[model samples]
Target: MMKEEVLSVLVSNHFGVLTRVTNLFGRRGFNIKALSVGETENPAFSRITIITEGDEQTLNQIQKQLSKLEDVKKAVIIPDDLLISRELLLIKVSADAENRPQLDALISEYSAKIASQQSDCLTLELTAAPEVLNLFIEKMRSYGIMEMCRTGSAALALGTQTVYHDAK
Candidate 1:
């Protein structure tokens, strides 16, 4: 059955590598829900975390195709049972004198921070699991969110496992 999957890919940290990976998804007709790429511990390589939807067969094909790419070293699904993941959000909400304290208290309750503040609005910065961020968004809707930016989820296998380790 087709279902959501998170993939961790290790690739050469060079120009065109990101393009190549994204193209693979487009070529295969798979929709990418979210993608994040950054340099790994070794500057020579990069780690990409991708959230997509596919079945077992499609996922297998993705793994094989990614491994065949010149710049891709490995691609493996990060099972929720063995994964640790988070996304970052920066949100600006309307906060006047009457509601400022309430917003501040709500932010503190969630361990979020006020990145900046103005007479009419307050910007909050938070890093947490996607679900937590969603709940925050839902609660803040009543306060009138002025703007928001989110960094798509990035994930890693829990414990000592490395992204580059060969999956068997």
Candidate 2:
């Protein structure tokens, strides 16, 4: 059975680390569904949230390989059994006076927030599971979608603990 995994990696904020990490996945032939990388609050570090789809054994191997990289401080595979995952999507829909109200109602049904509005378009921001976001995108197609952006899944382990592990 195909499964999806979210990996949160903490690495030194250095050039080429992203490429190296991505190359590792590429070498393994795992398709990355979504990837988000940003500097952490700490100036010296960055966090990478990667979503990939593969079988369980392949996912495990990818995690192990990522953890072994020199720049990688820690790599944790968020298990399906113990994490809450979500992605943020910004969708700009083409709208006109005639269909504006209808689009507004559809956005409300999805509980999307209006991030911006212009005479020709309305940008809606939604935070939900990937499936929900995909559903919204599909529905908006009929209304004419101008553009969209999605933040790859960011997940946290459920409970009071964090995923960081220090290596001496």
**lDDT values for all models:** 0.88, 0.87
What clash pairs does model 2 have? none
CA lDDT, candidate 1, residue 82: 92
Q: What is the C-alpha RMSD of each candidate to the true structure, in Å?
A: 1.8, 1.7
lDDT tens readout by residue for model 1, 96-164: 999988888899989999899989999999999888999999889999999999888889888887876
Please state the error at residue 125 of candidate 2 in Å. Answer: 1.7
Q: Evaluate model 2: give its TM-score.
A: 0.90
> Model 2, poorest ten-residue lDDT window?
159-168
Once fitted onto the true fold, the runs of candidate 1 whose alpha carbons sit more than 4 angstroms away are none
Candidate 1 lDDT trough over 10 residues, lowest sum: 159-168
Q: Can you give the lDDT of residue 146 in candidate 1?
A: 95
Candidates in order, TM-scores: namely 0.93, 0.90
